[model samples]
Target: MDSLPNLLWLRSFEAASRLGSFTAAGVELGLTQAAVSGHISALETRLGHALFHRTTRKVDLTESGRAYLPAVRKALQDLAKSTENLFGGKISGAVTLRAPISVATLVIAPALAAFLESQPELNIRLLSAIWADTALETNIDFEIRLGAGQWPGCQAEKLGDDFVVPVCSPFLAKGLKTPADLLKLPRAHILGFDDHWPRFFETLALPVHSPTPSVTVDTSIAALEWVSSGGGAALLLERAARPLAASGRIAIPFKEKIPLGQGHYLIHRQNAPPSRPAVRVTENWLRELFGS
Candidate 1:
């Protein structure tokens, strides 16, 4: 005879032993009372000992059943927790997310520390890149981009709208009075991008002229850093610049803002489901934070 009992049989035996009645165990376990009694009898026969003292008035555990109860209960508890950890809503794994430099710095990075604390078993790899190209790197679990909700071979959900205004150091804004005055100062424009400066001038109903930049940078975060170091005025996103401006890191020199009409979006592969729990949690958190 096998030394160990079947898992289901053991479960039935444990239930019957704890409840002190095969009928009560059957009700709890969704089994017939006869089935519960059979399981307990099989377990008792395998162990070569009677686990229960049958009685018409009330059933009771024999000394052997009492001794075996704690170990079986603990085993069942461990199995339940292990099953939950494997297949339940609680997740443990790494998620790779990619986004623009400024969004990574101003938006995601600020809230990430707390998020990691809450999900101790989860780890993340955040990459900073321009969202201009729709073709993201392979193996990227998630992405944040600025565009209409139409990326070929991917899924896109609109996060929210973004706008920009001219910002500079306090010293740079000291003598600046109006939008016209901003034109004469050496402006900092993002290289390979004409959206902010041209749209800004067009919003003011002025002729779009390419003004020479004191410094041309590749990313918005770099441009903001330059402006903070007294480089020159830069057109920066309103959401990203607000906190810095409030902290005196950078000052918005103009009251006018140029709206792009294009919204930010969360991106992932088309028809690809998020298999990892961490990915689902992070995606939900981002949607909550950035959704209008």
Candidate 2:
């Protein structure tokens, strides 16, 4: 009850920390950048520590800010959920969702504007994640993960499956007439996802040999960029590759794609169902959008 007066200031701090920009947080919170800065400054004055490292270009979280953010975010969610549950389930606050960078770019980013427009009262913060198995933050409301739909303590629902095909720039793809053509040319292996190159060649009944790649990358997005820049042929997920192919950035040399053993899923803690009707509705909307 003592901290109730500072609720708005806490929210401003959380938004700025999460977004990494005071201006961006201001836009989201419908406040002027100067006003947002004042709120943060006032909060910092009360807390007796700087929460952000101010820079000429952008703001970044200080060590103390990073430690405080999750607690603030969880408190906000709990308060919003409890209030909504008491008030007949009207969804009004934000939902924090995390997904892979590739998926965020390919699927959600494009559709998000219209979705937000339709649900004016609901806010969604979509964070780009690098790893599927990264530590699940206590404050995250939904996670879009790629796996067998079995998160330790979460309820997982399959969103969709994806497959990878050998792709290259239009100029490079022009020379490749057959699968064997890929073997002769330079190939860039996306370390984790393209470990199946040997198996794919085996499925084609070609003699299995260790492929010496022209280069190797850590993520599918980088591999796509490398291939699209005429770096070399590489295996990329069809969902990601198809758009690149359509946009003339890359081409699939063959229609055949190797099915990945895993799929994307929407997961949340099993013990903690979303108490807001709006959140539950959004969950249903995600299932429908992904065809679950």
Candidate 3:
């Protein structure tokens, strides 16, 4: 038979290592300090290794204990989660999500109804912004941001490149022949994407110009709304434009897709894991939707 330490002893050892004090661990485990110490002592004897260094101020993990902690912690967490999955009631909680306004409007907002229908107990607080600060917001549980794949004090998961294409209404597109013809119509510009049109024209070997009667919007969704309404032509991010184009409400005037330096990223605070189990579920849903 394979030998295994008692589960009770493992619990005492893990708690002591995490709290750094046998008395505190005992209090947390609802046992006397002596019982906690005895459990760990018994565990160490079984394993033939000291799990912690005896100290006057506080107990410290021994080299052996340090090596064993990660496995023990993970095992305990897995067991608890499995128990909950099989027997626990539905997870009910609010999850705060922040993303670019364009993504929230066109992509996530449209699909969220079905997601919520499946988990009626789940409450999602979806927030949108035209631009995100360099730092991740402490209040947000998840953030889908648009930027370069690097942010200070953040773990940025690059989703996709910022691919954009010029789109206009079908009526407006009928008058176009080449890239330069885009200049003849009103050029709708989205704020915070100043480099898009300039780089696009420069790439196609045409001089970039801002024409009169042009409109500017703060969000890509706004630009798409303007373009779909035949307000003029606008260069839109692929993710934002996909739904409208597929519905046949808009037309892609050029085959050229300008690949920008920045793109969509899933943001997390550096060194901080999610605070709730619901966060993991919500993240998986978003990642699946984004096809990342």
Instruction: Give the alpha-carbon lDDT of every model.
Output: 0.78, 0.78, 0.81
Write down the RMSD of all candidates, one decimal each.
16.4, 11.4, 5.3
Which stretches of candidate 2 lie above 4 Å from their native place? 1-92, 208-210
Which pairs of residues collide in candidate 3? none
lDDT of 3 by residue, 1-292 (tens): 3587888898888888878899988997899999999999999999999999989879998899999988887877787767767887676799998998888988889889999897788899999988788888878986998777788888888766667888999888888999899877787777787647778888888886663437878877777778888888888877667677778889887789888667778888864532456776687788778764
Q: What's the true lDDT of residue 235 in model 2? A: 80
- Output the TM-score of candidate 3: 0.69
- lDDT by residue (52-107, candidate 2, tens digit) is 99998789989998898878888888887677568754457787888888777767
On lDDT, the stronger of 1 and 2 is 1
Which candidate do you rate higher for lDDT, 2 or 3? 3
Candidate 1 lDDT over 139-207, as tens digits, reads 888899876779888778888777877998988888898887777667787754564776677778776
Stretches > 4 Å off in candidate 1:
1-89, 131-133, 136-138, 206-210
Instruction: Provide backbone clash counts, one per model.
Output: 0, 0, 0
